[model samples]
Target: MTSLPKTMHAVAATGSVPLDDERALLDVELPLPELRPRDVLVEVAAVSVNPVDVKTRGRRAADAPPFVLGYDAAGTVVAVGSEVSLFAPGDEVFHAGVITRQGTNAEFHAVDERLVGRKPSTLSMAEAAAMPLTTITAWESLFDRFGLRADSTGTLLALAGAGGVGSILTQLARQLTGVTVITTASRPETQDWSRRMGAHHVVDHHGDLAASVLELAPGGVDRVFTPSTTGRVPLFAEIVRPFGSIVAIDEDPDMDLRVLKGKSIAWLWESMFTRGVYETPDMVGQHDLLNAAADLFDDGTLVTTLTHEISGLDAAGLREAHAIVASGRSIGKVVVAR
Candidate 1:
């Protein structure tokens, strides 16, 4: 009989360096994980690359020891921990992992059953790998931050960038809410992609974003959404109508907040990792939300946002995937197969 192939392929950094530097990421072997008491072992068939993965690998430190890098995965389970009852060995699952430890950039990875969701039956592994992170961010931002009712028809203005999360956000807001969507993209390619994802209107984020928006919304947009850095925060004061809200997942840059003082507008931040990192009481909300997204996808109310496919589960493949994101040219998620 033939023996099984070794379950040891992994991607990692060999030394501290910038991602643009040559030899920044390297291939290596890692001992396959021994399932923890509450872990479910996933035989990674396909994994997707996100900006977070690139950020973690390029800038995160691991002392002298090497650390594995990856965040989103779609695969089948091969084993389960003693306490895991939600999954079986044959179950196909998907998850975007917690950032405190090593992630899914390997042949096999173990995750707590609480964080993993059954893969949407209607989507392929390459497509399914794109949902978790961006979905959570957009969902939480829509409901938690802007207070945009799922059934509201008020206008939403997405300022700056039209990549993965923005693409998914446009679709969900259009389908699930009473929101008229306008998105900002600096380039023609991004503008076209946003429109394809269902943005009702597209404008350039460069030049005068606020003036451009006001021209359309003399009364101002009901809400403003930003997926890019906080440097653009001040623009919200002029574009959002009085009492409207601005929601962001990007850094809170040094900008004057006094611009919105007269309007009573509020600013909100969405960080998807907050619950898992703090072990919040509602930590399981992530699992529930992702499962809901899966159901929506299977039932045909939603769609996956995969933009590119990079073959191989090795470092070179992963590096190429990372470069796509780092280049700021990626339209959506980039997936790699095992």
Candidate 2:
């Protein structure tokens, strides 16, 4: 067995104590995790922040100790648990880990091998790090939830097409499926980015989302994927073609799902962590899709969405990264590379 470092420096949330300070991240030393039967220890090279990270940090329980806060990561495997067989010590891998466990904001992280994939050779660690979480969410939304086929031709509408998940969702619907992707963006830059990502049409969500979409599809769209704010359920109901499906990843506790009844529209939720968080029998599906995404990236069929990046793995850098995400103005993704 290769020797492992005894302790690793990581950016973590300061203990459960409530605070009025703007700073939520702290640099702390934590002992390296002991591996489980199917685990791999990765020497992390890059990590990224998502809305979930900020939400999780905000909801941290009082009296809780420091908590690591990251999900998307790219790194090299340094060791594997006794029962592991998928990867060797020197392999490069990337994954969006299960939310129930410690996160990847450290020098080293232990993740289940089933949740990871071989890194795309064409991408640097930072580029690869920006992919996993968003890619997985987009993939599942299109294929698993909507049952979209690569050869089926129709229209798909993406709400907020320039954000992290929306950016990738637009690309996947365009490149992998036969769908004519129409995405919504409010700014010139966001519209340009969405068009470049392969959207057939870009409409402003700030305007009438339903009108903009109906102008193109006439009837409605075959599927709708929204990764941003979710209060637009009625708008989605108005524009979704009868029997079409609407999938979302955000929480909309106040959403009136009854609007879908008139059209018999399927309103579904996609949580990328459902497989890993529940330890499902199909957990390795994440690994499969990640590898599929890697192939597309390497072949130039899909593009990396890493738009912003920062240096260092310390607390200050993490705080800054989180601030950008919380601002709700960040396009694509914000990464922190060591």
Candidate 3:
């Protein structure tokens, strides 16, 4: 095996500073990540920014050491731990690193093999980097949380359909299931993007959300998938069919569950990091789903949602990617590639 470097170039959040702060993100040198028994050390080629990166950066303790803040990554595996069975050195792979571990915003990243998948033969590293995290969240929401299947028939209302998870979720629900996908996009560009992602109907979220949805789905949607749940659970209760489910990606601890009591609506949460963080028995499910998604990409059943790309994997590029994702107006995933 070739000798690996002891340290690598990386970008990290210096503190819980605002995005506008120059110290918010800085280039630093980090020791090459230490690998666990089932881990692989990947030479990261590209990374995509997500809401989690911004949230993690903003909430990091000021006193804490500068921390890496990326999750979705595409790279080539350079080494593997003794117990790793799924990948060998030189394998091109992609994965969303677990939140509990050091993140992927570095020249090299250590990730458990069970959470990694072979990169799609059809996608560039930047394109593949835009997928893993959002893809897993969307897949688990539709298949695991809602139990949607190829034969399942219903209407799905995806809030913020032009966003990362929403973009992919719209395609998965439309292509894999019999559901009529209704997505919310207040802007013309996003509406067009939603349609391109396979949404059967696009409703303006800035308007009367419930009214717009009701017009398209007169009986209320069979399922509602929301990226944000604060101030929206009540709206979900109003537009979801009785006994239907609502899956949320964001955390809303104070949300009132009573609002959905009248209709007995089921409320669920999806955190793609759950299985890896807790080392659940189904942790390998991420690998499986990612491989499935890769096949779909290779076969042209799915397409990359990356709409914005930065030229290099440096602090400036990452900051720009973060800014794009933080703008709340980005129509799809934003990536930074080497």
Candidate 4:
């Protein structure tokens, strides 16, 4: 085995302060991550900022240890644990790590092999990094939560169509199913981006959302996928068909469930980390989905949503990427790469 460094460069959230505060995220040196039986140590080449990172940063306790805050990563494996059989040293892999574990904002990361997948042959590390988290979330929302299939025909209304999760959801739903995809975007660029991602209809979310959707999908939509604006569950209830379903990824503590009771509408939540965090029997399903997505990427059936790229893996670059994601208007994924 090759000798590895004792410590590595990393960026961590040192305090629960605003993004502008220098103490919010800091450059630090941490010991190389310890590997478990199912783990593999990766030399991280790139990472992408997501809304979770911004949320996690603000919610870190005052006295807690500095928390690394990246979920999406693409890197090369440098070593594997005793029971690991999925990958070997020098293999390129990508994954959206579980929230319960340490994050991937470091020169090296240790991740469970069941949660990782082979990096797409056709994509650069940055592009590959931009995908895993959003792809898994979107995949689970459409197929696992809503039970959408290639032959199933219905209209799906995806709120915030140009955001990271929405971007990939649109592509997956359009290319893999017979359903009509209706996505919401307020800006011209975002509207165009939504169409390019395979949305059949792009409605202005700034206008009357229900009216705009009803215009395109009369009789209400069959499914609603909300990555943001989850507080509008009542509005979704009014716009979804009887026996329809709604899946949300954002946190909505005050969301009332009674609104959908009359129509028997199903309300579902898709958390991609649930399996990995709990060590569920189907945890390896992520590996299968990611490998499937990689094939789609290689065959040109799907494309990376990365729109902004920052050079370097230091705290300054991560802060910039986090700021972009926190702005809530970033068109696609913003990545920080080596």
For each of the candidates, the C-alpha root-mean-square deviation to the true structure, in angstroms, is 2.5, 1.7, 0.9, 0.9
Q: What lDDT does candidate 3 reach at residue 239?
A: 92
Q: Model 4: per-residue lDDT, tens digit, 1-338?
A: 67999999999897687789988999999999999999999999999999999999988887778988799999999999999999999999999899998899999999999999999999999999999999999999999999999998989999999999999999999999999999999999999999999999999988999999988878999999997745697898889999999998886788898999998999898999999989999999999999999999999999999999999999999999989999888998999999
So what's the TM-score on candidate 3?
A: 0.98
Please give the lDDT score at residue 43 for candidate 2.
95
> Which one wins on lDDT?
4
Question: Which residue ranges in model 4 land beyond 4 Å of their true spot?
Answer: none
lDDT of each: 0.81, 0.89, 0.93, 0.94
Task: Please write out the lDDT profile of model 3 over residues 226-258, one tens digit for every residue.
Answer: 898888888988899899999988978888889
User: What residue pairs clash in candidate 4, if any at all?
Assistant: none
TM-scores for all predictions: 0.92, 0.96, 0.98, 0.99
Residue-by-residue lDDT tens digits, candidate 2, 245-333 = 88888877788889899999988899999999999999999999999999999999999999998999888788888889878788899
Give per-residue CA lDDT, model 1, range 222-306, as digits (tens): 8887767556656677778899988877766577778888899987878888887777888778888889899999998888888
Sorted on lDDT, highest at the top, how do the candidates line up? Answer: 4, 3, 2, 1
Predicted structure 3: lDDT: 0.93
Let me know the TM-score candidate 2 reaches against the reference structure: 0.96
Worst 10 residues of 4 by lDDT: 227-236
Clashing pairs in 1: 152-178, 153-178
lDDT score for candidate 4 against the true structure:
0.94
Candidate number that wins on TM-score, 2 or 4: 4
Count of backbone collisions within predicted model 2: 0
